[model samples]
Target chain A: MSAATADPGNGTILRAHRVTKAFGGLVAVKEVDLEIPPTSIVSLIGPNGAGKTTFFNVIAGILDPTSGHVEFRGDRMIARPIRTWFEPVVWVTPSVVAGVISVLVYLATANADATALAVLAAIGLLIVMFLAAIVRPRWYLRLLATAGVFRSSRPNDMVKAGMGRTFQNIRLFANMTALENVQVGMHTKMRANAADALLSTPRARAEEKASQARAREFLGIVGLRGRAGELAKNLPYGDQRRLELARALASEPTLLLLDEPTAGMNPRETAQMTQLIDRLRRDLGISILLIEHDMKVVMGISDRIYVLDHGELISQGSPDAVRADPRVIEAYLGKPAS
Target chain B: MRPDIVRVLQPIVIIAVSLVVVWLLLGGTQQFMNFLTLGAIYALIALGYTMVYGIIELINFAHGDLFMFGAFVAMWILTVPLGMTGAVDNPLQLTVILVVVMLPTMIVMGLLGTFIERFAYRPLRHAPRLAPLITAIGVSFILQNVIYSVFGPSPVNVPQVFPLTRFEFLGGRVSFLSLFMVAIAVFLMVLLQLFVGRTRLGRAMRSTAQDREAAELMGVDINQTIAITFFIAAALAGAGGTIQGLYFGSVQFNLGFFVGLKAFTAAVLGGIGNTTGAALGGFVIAFIEVFATQLGYSRWSEVAVFTVLILVLVFRPSGILGQQLGERA
Candidate 1:
């Protein structure tokens, strides 16, 4: 855990140390260490079934690592703040006790006057349990979690923590308008509750207006300004890909993860996407971690690349160095035909 | 005209034409007012159904039961605690009682909705769609029996606490209570439209409905958004229940069962996922029911509503305002 925060001056924005993920008996991602420095584009390249997506899933908090840790901006992704045992006790013990007491009272009262008292007591106990859960000290909570009250960070938490991603396939909200899709990405940034929404309070209204303006700005950034009102499903293939990128950017992420951004694009669309990726790095000044199948895109854009083979990082270096490595070549193309 | 502008105006024109035709057929304003009041109540309930379906695609069979419980809650508050078994003559006292009863009922029902989602629907989120549908029916029965056990099977007569003052407009007499209910319903509908169109959480809801995975990737908390949707929908249902109690002066344990089905029909009629459409569908169904009853088909009103639902499914499956089949957004 201390290693997670060891280097503040190194400019590394994300660090995954010995990260491993397993599904049942199958080890999908072996112990892998990787780092993405600030304002740099790092590509993770591999052949099919190389576990790139699994690795992405782990870091993105979509899947929890069986072992090892992922730290983003010096914060661990999975935290066991309380002992595991404490959580159950805090959550369940009062209810069990109340149930027992209620049954005893009911029996003692012969279903009479005391039944009300028993109900009141049970409600009181439940309230106390809720209060304890909400007001307990962090250290005490962590101690309880250690006894098995574990809570894992989720993908939305990662997004709120300044990480954003797009899927391998275009996962844009197909039924939503392009502008609305981007507005959804701004969920964490906006602050309005149900009451505010129902009452149409001034603050909620102002926040809504600001979010719409920002959503439109994001659309413009993605070069889909005029198509903001168009449904995402109606967008062309290339436009849909860019719309996904726009939606991701609306989260105001410091680190962007793009998975196969150009998977189905033609040569012209692919080149255009490549340029947009370069511009994202240059203009936005945000660090990017990309998982791509196309070697040309990787070689042309990646400042540093990591090559995976059989769920293991076989090589890591600059584009030219990784391309020149015999192991990487063999991993991608296999042994020479002769 | 551009297609988008035409799309927006088409529904307005259709509704206007229908209203004019109904006006001429009814030959009187009183009947239309009655239909409007009933339509408002149905619209309120339909909004709940449409909202929950939009976000999670769950029918929430317990919703009608929630509305029933809301009526029961209001009844208890008025009869047992507030001691308002008869109509209050003082406007200020009436206002206070309405606020006291309505606010707590909405809150409690909203919380119950959240609880139902957490326990019943959330677990089956990833299961086959039919699984939740069955669970929803099960929940509906549980709620119905719970109410039956507590309140008995007899209809509880709700005291008409609302003022019965009538106002004459354009040779039509409209009760203040009816007008009030319609106004409240319209207010809520407008707020809902603005929220979904403009607010951040509303955007999250629409996105989640369209694509749950994509919404999560964009930092939208799918669970929280769904929970909020349930809360809002149930709260609206609660409001509708209160109005129903005041309007009809009686509530039965099975009140939700019939109303819930009607609301579901309304949702489908207005396009299940479209918010404003559900409201329109509710009013449309109300008009159909009222007209049928007036035309000496009182026994067949329910049949008529169902027939309309089937017709919509067969000819225009998307309902009146539904987008084209492949363009459901």
Candidate 2:
């Protein structure tokens, strides 16, 4: 289904220029200038202490960049905070402000000044909205802090925009079937309102049926139609990995960030996953920013490779060129056998 | 009975023989049927607890209280000028219409269950399991007192007083009240069974019950699915409450106490997380209690129920349908 997957956007879709991340005293990633052009397979390969996962975490919005801002399609990405209680109170602030302003105008002009009052009310509402646009997030952040959820919104929310990720260790629902796993990834796109679902009306039923069909379709795309009915945990290790990819694809993302997709796979499974990744980039229309420890898999699929040694990119180039580079070989093959 | 029929009718035969013995002891058929009817009612409430536990892996201690609220609300509605009492010749028609009218109220209780899961259970979702369970107990206490404060402690008589009419048998009187209660409870239970077994929400619930994260990854909103489970349990309890009030003819603020424990025990007996098992568990407990009572052991009926529960749990921790099912990815 990812066939002819032309880049949906023109020009560099995501540009991370001079991004650095520090953790108190230690620098986790330093001066990482990168251009992630749309719809291309790009591999981030490195040794154990390479900070590849850390870099992926930062880009996926799990971690904030210590310095550099991420610009995607020219629009600055905003990291939205997870849900909190104070959100409801934050929502009504605009309406409350509008009410106060409208009342003040009414008291000043009396009922005869209809046109002026309307315009004043409209302007007041607009101002409240603008203020809300600025303040709601602040309110949410404050609430999250108070709620002890932990956030440094600047780097976090910024990272989340247009970026999604999967954990290194498989975190599949042990009891949920394979199909349901993929369904959860499409959560943000669900059109059915909560009220409609509870009501169980014909419209809601129709929407739900359609969603189920779509969920089945995604599972099939990953060649997991046979395992769809089985619980994810029950699937063999390789199938579980495939299930994770299916789930990732369900997000319908522009950039697919894979964290060790073939970490525990045998050669056959690794080869299959590599092909899937290549097909994903070519057909699914997603720019692959991948982290794989297996050099063979990396070299087999990577169009361009970036090698990191100690929290910094040591070398980067086309696969054959990077592989031939003495510096890249020194980083991995160890001082050229002394 | 033929050998094939005997194999199929084993439990029924045992119960039939037990009924005959009870008839001899109680001096008749009407009393035996009364016991049977009461068992059916408890089974209804027990079924709710089982269904909920089966899906979300929650004990839902407050379910019994939700049922109690159902009875109270139904009583309030019936007592008001809105419900008519006089033209109640057909108890089936009257009771059916009454319970049917109570659906919205039951649905409201379901919403309340959803709220409990959100404000109470959601925060404790990541914390230790014991945390939310304690929260559930706290909620139950709050609801009981809330009822006492609003409606008072007195037994509120349900105004649509359908007179008890016993259908006389070889030895006793099977009242219209008992018949009506048994009929409605059984019908609703079957209806609920069909709804849960065959529906999409039911599948979502089963999935959530399995593994919440996996379910969430599948686009099943964990919170939404949990809420739906709560709603279903709450609605079931509400329906049970309405039935209890109609059957017993009064609803007390403390009605949930006994019913809640019984339902819990029923859930345990049926297997905590098995929906069909919970319903069957309820009936079994009721039958055991009814038989114990007939044997001049009425005072120890609750003890017998607990003993049976403990015995079952010792053997099968997952309960009757403990199939180690899931919802995670």
All DockQ scores:
0.51, 0.20
lDDT of 2 by residue, A1-338 (tens): 00112333656656666778888978988988666787887888888877888777666554668888655555433333444455544545556676676677777777647746665776666545433333243444454456544333332133233344455778775666687666656554555543454556688678667767888887877788777779777899999988888877776777677888888889899899888888878877778888876678889878788887778988888999888888888878789555
Could you tell me the interface RMSD of model 1? Answer: 4.3
Quote the B-chain TM-score, candidate 2: 0.85
Model 1: residues with Cα > 4 Å off, grouped in runs: A1-9, A22-27, A79-148, B1-14, B89-93, B170-172, B324-329
Question: Per-residue CA lDDT of candidate 2, range B1-329, in tens?
Answer: 59879787996887578657756755567556756666676776777677666665667777778778878777777766456554377757776667555777686677677767767877877787788778878888888888899899898877656665556666466676666667777777766665544345555566567655444434454555666667777877777777787777788999998878887888777777666677777777777787777778999989998888788878887777675443233
Best by TM-score: 1
What are the models' TM-scores? Answer: 0.88, 0.75
**For residues A1-338, what per-residue lDDT tens digits would candidate 1 score against the true structure?**
11122335667888889988888998888998999998899999999999999999887877768999887887777733234345546656667778788888888768856777777777877656544443333343454545555554556767877888888888777777888888888888887876687777999889888888898999988899999989888999999999989988988888899999999899999999999988999999999999986778889889999988888898999999999999999998899888
